[model samples]
Target: MSDDLIPGDESSAADAADAVYRELLERLGEAQPQPRLGATKRALELLGNPESSFAIIQIAGTNGKTSTARMIESILRAHGLRTGLFTSPHLVRFTERIGIDGERISDEAVARNWDDIKPYLAMVDAELTAAGEPALTFFEALTVLGFACFGDAPVDVAVVEVGMGGAWDSTNAADAEVAVFTPIDLDHVQRLGKTIAEIARTKAGIIKPGAQVVSAAQHPDARQAIVDAAAAVDDPAVFEGEEFALVQDAVAVGGQLITVRGRAGTYPELYLPLYGDHQGRNATLAIAAVEAFLGGATQPIAEDVLAEGLTEVASPGRLQLIGTEPTVLVDAAHNPHGAASLVAALGSYFDVDEIAFVVGILQDKDAAGILTTLAPAASGFFFTQSESERAIPAEELSRLAASLDLPASTFADTLDEAAEDARRWAEEAPRRLVVITGSITLVGEAIEVADDREWKATA
Candidate 1:
């Protein structure tokens, strides 16, 4: 096909792409999660099973999935491989979820690929309707689109992050060669399960027969579930702090320095340009996962390549510093465990005497649990809600904080107002900090507001 004969002109491609994205958003209005592999499987089969064309690594857990997936993609790309990365709940652009060769897929590519797959998607919709099943969901369609894009890119490997629980998640349509699990917690109790063991069992479903499984140290119940799952599949399983470990970590200027005892060999003095000890642990898991993927825990990656990959790793909306001089940091800490990690990282890394938090949370999350975890480090709170329909109202959050005996104020407006209020509170003192957190959507909004206000880090 000639360039002139394309569906839209170059200047109009963005609008065309956005229209396609809007159609995908319309699928979310139903919100009826078809948590099964059937829809995605059928869709991919129609697309010629592009997911199987490339080597796949699947990462699943309550948190750190996106960060670990990014790390794995970066390390694999550093090793001179073309890598495709599919992550969920993008901070900004829809295109952020799909990456090829270390960069997000372009809007033009999104438009072109959607056009190419539209017919096959329609076919799947018809098939599902005939079977008295609902059509493909927003996530299911997106998963199929990502696989098709990866196949078109002809990437050597693809790092895929599960959107939710691993078993029957849309991405599970692809059998991964490597299955990685981060810490499993009690966040998504309504969908996954109510207990740690139940959640771990749901997550362990990602481990396929003959696939290598790498996991973080877990609670006893969670650990047993993973071990049992691996045993059932006859797969080799490596757990952090046992098979591989983060040997040492110290706070550095911009981020942290760590040494990892990988399954293959001990890697020392790796500079990870991200904060938090949890991140250091995540880096160790990423290294071990890469080691497992390349070879079975015995072959070592080149030191320089590993270092370069770690240096280039970026996990935005996760304790990301957006501004300084009355410093502003944004973290997507929606649950108690994540909130505790945020508070710990703040205490260990930054020198702020006090912190004012701009907090927003989803309706289903444990607001009291999060506030309690954050209470130790928080000097004040600015409660707000993100754009998500599921977010709790700011006044409700403020009331919850009051019950918890935490000093709180309510923005009851936009996240921008909450962020600015927090910033003003921080500006009153020389070494005060403003932290925008509690939800990923809130952190994303804070970042956008910071960018618009030209708020650069002055430190």
Candidate 2:
């Protein structure tokens, strides 16, 4: 065999990145998803515990974790600090999970880091194997990789969104300085818990001793659970309604204008370039978390910095409008709670008379509940699935919609076809909208299709 055939061959950076990504995919395919912390903690330990090199803000919740995390990262970066963001379930590319200074990690960086850490990862894998535990899952490995990348970047702060329940999640291995919860509800019941209280309790585990815990206004039971958790740890807990709130919000052109009452002071007329009162609340929570992280509520961020941060922030696939003419929007609202938020946003933001919804949901989600919540806003439905193994069949989803007395049609083929059909239906009726939603995977696929068709309108 030639020298080039050796593992340390003279491959281009892109080629090396591709090789590393392929190996990651292989590991991802074999992932067993054992929701435990041992594997990840061990891996981090083997890698010299890169997660401890920087301060961390861990955001956990059912629906808005990613959006909130993104907002926090943007705000912190606006403060002129080098920030690292680690979020899960990337919409299109794996690189989306790790960002430094508001940019996705470069392929060369990923490859270089992976190459540097491969031996350590292998050592951890062998240790786990010898201990009779399964190897690190996809998320676990990715979490370690993200921490390593962030350490190599030498970021001042890292904003992390929990992949699953906060306590045992792979990312939880990092001791977060600030733990933020955004409107926890019933989600991942099979893994988290069956009740809102149970889920909140699981999420509240992210609260470390002396950590400043920030939570959105939650249901009474959920609130109690989080409060109890914080009390147990002797941490200072701040709740939205009691400590901070969206004082005023109005639908604005492009997005929404709002006033927020933070722990220290009130900021008014902040324009967040994102739709929905829910998003407004998310922004408030992010602001509060950042305040707590930088200083307690008494220290407010510079007014100019806060305004620039909110203005520059963007949450793609969360009530995002990707097209015009016959307006096409996409949202990743898979659960009933998220669906309710989507429905509210649709009613409050857009003036369309009707909406043709192209929905695809995972098998585990409450498809009926989602359809029920969205039924009032939808004129018709085109049921489709994403390129996910867990996606429910289009016919099955249509049947579910029909049972709810919703007008439904099946597009079992592809998101592109489903979108085209929805667009045509919307065009047939003036002032109508076309929406692709229900599953994040579906929204990601639809976004790809929209980009390919040049359907995305420039701002």
Candidate 3:
């Protein structure tokens, strides 16, 4: 517990570090939930305001946030700018949370930086105790560490993914030159408000005073909330499909090809290698954000650089195909809105009679809603729990899927076994698709198993 002690100084150092990080995360879950706009500022104030050391592109929404953040970072990097990207809920290693110069920060870097920041963390804890306040949660500490990493590396810009709702989320502490909103929907009713209006209001909190706001096309109510929130901050709002638009979208050779028209300019034949109609919208937001970041200081963006940038960007787990021949696609569609998008994209890309599905979900998610959207397109369900302690139990999830009168079965705790079962069942023909979805954790596990099995190679 002492700051001077290094968790991994000995043979058990790795385990000790894991234990420390786990404890931090638990404390973060237990800490007072700020769910408002200024908690980040308080945390940053305690940390010497490292968040202001660099410019930022702030992204918040119910979905596509990670993709949008990656797209913006890629575009910025292609323009010869050194960029730092911070995202969350890693698919594999925890180090995926921070990317510098388009690569995951090295494990050595994570450990060394964590060790260096432990003293600051201890100080923060002591101050909280003295003030009769809860200690910094794992997320708060990690947010501080990101600022430290970015400041230390001294990247020109940082693309920050909001941990949860925008306003009170810890990442909001950073000053953003451009605030981007991906679509908003009902999720995280506990921390964020339940209604669309409430969720929209909470997300709109990221729009800073004088920042340029670029948003994915939103529902009318959500759009209004953003408008009102921007007015309060006196920020200029660029509404997708209104202030800017993607005039054309189609499947290109490398990925999706689209054209965007901003308020003041137009970009043609932009190639983004990600799939899905939603990505087209996400790409437009990214383009608008890049334009906004440039501050009209440059003429229209260089098309050659933009094309290369978009083609090189990769967002794993969003309609990602992990195997072929009874193709296995892994999508992190944990909610109804995302599930709907996944279904639409599948419809666009593949034609199959029966879609076999492996699904595991968290308890906080709308299980019934997600199932409803996916069940119609599914032939059967292989139910299991993903990585969250909050995940719905396998049997219970099966029952929920069965209540919809869809053929469903529960699996043992191991994702590897569950995925094996799903693949075997779908192997009557190689083209019969197997889909593992619901939570990113489950998809990650499935991907790991599929990799070990060489499922794609054999398929």
Candidate 4:
């Protein structure tokens, strides 16, 4: 291998970080989050409760949680706060899940922190075993490690995205000062609950006794659940379409222009370089979240700070263009709601008619709902799978697609090959594009493939 691919010392650090991730995988995966935080809290307590060392803003929802968390982190950083951001299901490296000041936490940092926390975690594991309970799952351990990393960095604030439904997700142990909810819908039905109300109620558990609550527009059932949760704590949750809203948004070059009516003030004429009208709502929710965090939504953020934050905001793997001359876009739109937003963004942001989607869905996801949502705008489907063991097989996906009367393409040994074939088909016609979607795991693998192949975007 060339030194360009793996330089001596730097490559060693990355390999070490990868080793840390592998050790985490040896535990139970995040597919089934444990319904209790006692294990996580016990581990943290042994480490002096590092999560309590910094102020936290925790986000929970079925969709847009990671994007909204990034926005809040960026704005807080723009305001001169040393910020720590933790999002889920990294699109490239495990380090991407934890960030210090908008940059991925370094490989060396991840390795060092994991080493420091291993002993404390082992103690917690023994305690759980003795009590006849399961040890901490992958996400639970990772949350502890992430918070320890942030506390050691001594950040001014930390923005965290829940790994799953909020109530018992390990990050909930942090007791975030601001509880932010993105749109809640049917997701993780097996683990969370069967209906939207059940899921939303599970999510609202992040709202503690005195935490400020900020929410995006939600289904009536979802909204009521959050309202009830907040009232129980004597906290009035500020919501979009009510106290705050995405007042205006128009398609702009490379992104969109937006105006938001926040609880404390009105932010007009903002340039947010993220696709979808959904992103505009995510931005408004983020603004309100920061408002509540800094000054209880009673003082407006300075216009320049807000402008800088929005201008620099980025939501990768969400309508992100990875190539040109054929036009390949990757979006982590695994569920029906996110799929609907992707279709809308394509209609509004780009001049594409037919899309050949290189798709892969997880084992337990709502494949029918997601594919059905995309079927109306799709020309063909290139069924594929990621390295994730949870990914549904390409042949199985092909069978599902055929049953839906959607055209299916041949499978490939790898996602990169599938994307290449889809892009080739797209390049043969005018105003056609290739989209890679359905799972974050697939998008993450596609990103690595894109980087390796140097798929530069001319547009």
Per lDDT, the best of the predicted structures is 4
Residue 126 C-alpha lDDT in model 1: 95
* Candidate 1 deviant stretches above 4 angstroms: 1-11, 29-31, 457-459
Candidate 2 residue 68 Cα shift, in angstroms, is 0.7
Question: Once superposed on the true structure, which residue ranges of model 3 sit more than 4 Å away at CA?
Answer: 1-23, 30-43, 296-298, 407-411
Number of colliding residue pairs in model 1: 0
Between prediction 2 and prediction 4, the one with superior TM-score is 4
Candidates 3 and 4 compared: the better one by TM-score is 4
Worst 10 residues of 4 by lDDT: 1-10
Lowest summed lDDT over 10 consecutive residues: which window, candidate 2? 1-10
Q: Score each candidate by Cα lDDT.
A: 0.88, 0.87, 0.81, 0.90
Which portions of model 4 show Cα errors greater than 4 Å? Answer: 1-8, 407-409, 457-459
Model 1, 1-459: lDDT tens digits are: 223335547656767667778989877432356778988998888888898889999999987889899999999999999999999887877889999999999777887788899899899889888998878889998998899889998899999999889897899999999999999999778888999999999999999998999999898999999999999989989899899999999999899999999988999999999999999999999999999999966699999889889999999899888887668889989899999889989999988788889899988788899999999898889988999898899988898888888875666578877777788788887889888899888888888888888789643
Per-residue CA lDDT of model 2 for 143-229, tens digit only, reads 888999999998999999998888898888999999999998888888889999899988998988979999999999889988999
Q: Alpha-carbon error at 38 in model 2, in Å?
A: 1.7
Model 4 scores a TM of: 0.96
Name the lDDT of candidate 1: 0.88
Worst 10 residues of 1 by lDDT: 1-10
TM-score, each model? 0.97, 0.95, 0.92, 0.96
Pairs with steric clashes in candidate 1: none
Higher-ranked by lDDT: 1 or 2: 1
